[model samples]
Target chain A: MLQTDSLKFSYPKGQTFGFPNIGCKAEETLLILGNSGTGKTTFLNLIALLLRPSSGELIINNTQTASLSEKQITEFRAQNIGIVFQKPYFVNALNVSENLLLANYLGNNALDKGKAAELANSLGFEHLLSKKVQELSGGEQQRVCIARALMNTPKVILADEPTSALDDENCEKVADLLEKQSKIIGAALIVVTHDHRLKSRFNNQITL
Target chain B: MLIKIVWKNIWAKKLNSFLCILLMMFGISIISLLINIGNQMQDKFSKNISGIDMVVGAKGSPLQLILSGVYQIDAPTGNIPMSELQSLQTNPLVKQVLPLSMGDNYQGFRIVGTTYPYLKHFEADYAVGVVFKNNMEVVLGATVARKLNLKLNESFASSHGFEKEGEAHGDKKYKVVGILKSNNSVIDNLILCDLKSIWEIHEHEEEHANETPEKHTEHANEATEEDFDITCALVKFRSPMGLMTIPRLINQNTKMQAALPAIEINRLFELMGIGIDAFKALALAIMLISGISVFVTLYNALKERKYEMALMLSMGGKRTKLFFILMFEGLFLSLSGYILGVLLSRIGLWIASRMLDQNFNFDLQQSMLQKEEIYLLIAALLVGIFAAVIPSLGIYRINISKTLAND
Candidate 1:
């Protein structure tokens, strides 16, 4: 489970943001819909522990993250948080399988090649595991990104604008994959995007 | 995994990495070559001049005396009366003395009229036949024998001067009776003959000149056994008293000047050190520039890969791990360059030794690694780490949210 309470953040230039309290249980999906400059990515970054909230309480798997040290937060984030970003960014130098293994490496876990292959098979990109990221098509790259995020089986999966650049078919397929993968891992799935097509796909919704 | 990532990153920027490696290789090769050549040459020079305490020759440049009498690399200043050297040899403070009679060459190898003691001093042994036992018989040094392709019983006419192409001593030829083993010393380049042969050759030249009345000088009739002369005499002292009194006594009382090999060699090194030091500074400057290029390459790469860095950071990679990835790139480039540089320097030394052997009969093929080179490697690593750390510090400043959100 992932929960946030009255999350607030401010940039050095004096722009402050106050977000509504949000909560999601394991195997649930939350859709955050917002237009440009809605601080949707900032909210995801805070829950990812990438950006420390100025004033907030972030609880993931029943552990409060606000008071954790920097190192502890980084470790905790690596072990329990999975992020799928927009545009399907993978390390250009690594093959598809190595990209997934990188997630395990960063999470301080022994590389599970079997888990990577299984995820690749489930995501329908097992044949593309040895190929470079640039060799993959748009849909294949999205599927690899989903597999990479699910590598550590984190308690919360956050995605930023994951379907904004895809076609209607690929976007729905990606949304379904993200939900299906998170449900299989029993993790809370949170997606932030400006795409209005995802609003009906998710029952729990927030608009900014 | 980190190493693999670093390798891939370097391969991805192949051109930039190659440029850095080339620059480093150039700098390191220059420094290593300088050190190797300088060390080998100094070692050879010191080894060749070790036993002789003082060189007594005609009053002239002391450096020329040491270079000619001990190292046999320079022309003799002039000849001193053999009677004068004989008296010095008998002095109580003098343990031994070896007279050197130069002024003739057989195919560019100097013919030194010295005794068995000189050969023993260098620990030379005959590789073929036996040592010269007669006035016309000769024993060739290893290099001379090999280069001239001379064998026992082969005869070659001596040239009148130090140069290879000088006027020939037409009436007489010296037969090679022996060839010396390679001893890696000055003796390896000499043509050894009896002192009587040098005197006989000069006497015959004087007699021939006397036949032409117009060219005859008063000294034509002065050639005799008692009045014979030698170019220089190498002196070794029996004790410290000889070192204190012998050279000064010779300088003050005799027409000949005494040159201490140690002092003259030191002066020669001091003069040559200026050039070596300048070259060393030039090598160091090139290394510094290479280091700066590494810094620029990595710094630009970090700037260009800001988004990638942010993505790695968001994947829960520590900033320090990303920093090390860049550091490893720099270390890998410098280490490869250093290894190649060392090998190239050894190749350079081998080529130099071959050329020197062909021309000067000096061997410089000692390809052993020096302690200074280990220090150089450490310095290179420090330079690599320092150059990399400056730019990789940007990892700490990367705002993952801003970078990811903006991209």
Candidate 2:
């Protein structure tokens, strides 16, 4: 579970981002919708613990995330969070398997090669695991990124415009993969997107 | 995983990586070549004069005596009185005295006249014919024999000076009595003969006949007499006695000056030492600059990859892990550059040594990669780290919320 009580964040001196209070529960699919200047991405970042809230208590899994030291915050994030990005940035030189291996390494977890392979195969990435990240198509790269995100079996999945670049068919495919994977792992699935077509797929929605 | 990422990143910009490595290789090769040649030159020059304790010559330049007597590459200073040489030979401190006379050249090499003692002093066991015995008999250095293609018993006339075309000692042909083995010394460029042969050829030269014809005639006809003059005398002490006493006696009592081969060579190295140090400093600077380039490039890449970094951060990659990831990239680049540089340098040295031997007849032996090269490699790696430190800070600054929001 993630809780942000009276969360206030701004880019600089006068630019405000997150609202004063926002929270999302575990195992729920969140649809955060907002106009360009509102703090939709900022709220997701705050919830992900990547940025310090200007003022408030931000908690995840019963721990006050905002109160944790930088090192502790890093450890907490590694153990509890997963992220998928819109453009699907990857370490281009590495093959899909190697990229996933790094996620496990950064998480301070022993590589469960069998589990990683299983995840890849179930997500239809089995043959693509040996290919370099740059060689994969956009949809394939996004799936690999998703596989990377779930490698450590974290409790929260925060996706930022995860399907923005994909075609309608591929977008649904990616959303299906994210929703199914999050449910199987028993983690919160927070999907941020401008596309209203995904509203029906999520069980929960947060309007900014 | 860190290594894999770094490698992929590098391969992504293959041309840039290749360019950087090529530049490093070029720098390394030049340094290696210069260092190796300098080493070989010092080795060959020192070996050329190894056995001679002191070089006694006419009262003029000591360097000239060393160049002509020990190396046989320059004009003799002048001849000394035979009586003076005889008196020095009679000294109880004198172990062996090999008199040298120079003034002629076969092809472009100096023809040196000395006794069998000179060959023994250099440990020159003839590779092909017997040692010099009769008048006008010449022993060829390994290089000289190979170059002119003159085998044993083949006769070649001597030139007056080092030039190929000059006043020739055409009247007195010197038969090649022996050919020496490759010694990697100045001796490899010389033609050796009896001291009397040099005296005999120059005794009646046109230039000498114009000024000192009577003096030449006096020495030529008075061969039966105990009077003679040699260009220089190579002296080895019987014990430490000559080392302590002979130089002092020669400097004070005689007109000739005795030069210690080791001391003069040491002085020469001291003079050249500054240049070598300067070259080393330049090499250090290049390595430092290359390291900085690596750091700056990676750091810049990190800034551009901020969103990606934040994505990783939110994916549960720790700040410390991210930090190490950047640092390891730098380490990988520097180490690869250094290794490549070393290989290039070694090859360059081999090529340079070959060229030197071919052109100068100065044999430069191929040496192993030196220990200092390792230090250079370490320096490069450290520089790489220094460059990466500032940029890796991006990982800590990446705002996961903003990055994910913007995405």
> Which prediction has the highest TM-score against the true structure?
1
Off by over 4 Å in 1: A10-16, A54-56, A66-68, A112-141, B125-131, B140-181, B202-224, B238-255
Predictions in order: lDDT: 0.88, 0.77
Compared with the true structure, what per-residue lDDT tens digits does model 2 show for residues B1-407? 66666677778767666655555555565566567767766877788777789999888778777877776656778888667878878888888888877767877777888888787778886789988888889999898898889899899888887677877776778898899997666667889998777776776564455666676555656463246677888898888878988898898888889988888777777878888778867776666666666766787678767766776776567777778888877777776777787777777766776776555555556577766566666666666678677888777777666555554
TM-score of structure candidate 2: 0.76
Q: Give the per-residue lDDT of model 1 (tens digit) for A93-199.
A: 78899999999998899999999999998888999999989899888898898899999999999988888888999999999899999999999999998888898
Tens digits of per-residue lDDT for model 1, B113-176? 9877888888889899887789988888898898899988999899988888999998899999
For A29-136, candidate 2 gives per-residue lDDT tens digits of 778877766776777777777778888787788888767987788778888888786778776656789888877877788978887899999899899878878788
| Reproduced native contacts, each prediction | 0.60, 0.73
TM-score of 1: 0.89
TM-score of chain A of each: 0.98, 0.95
Candidate 1 local accuracy as lDDT? 0.88
TM-scores of all models?
Answer: 0.89, 0.76
For model 2 the local lDDT of residue B329 reads 75
TM-score of chain A of 1: 0.98
lDDT of 2 at A10: 68
Question: Residue B228 of candidate 2: its Cα lDDT?
Answer: 65
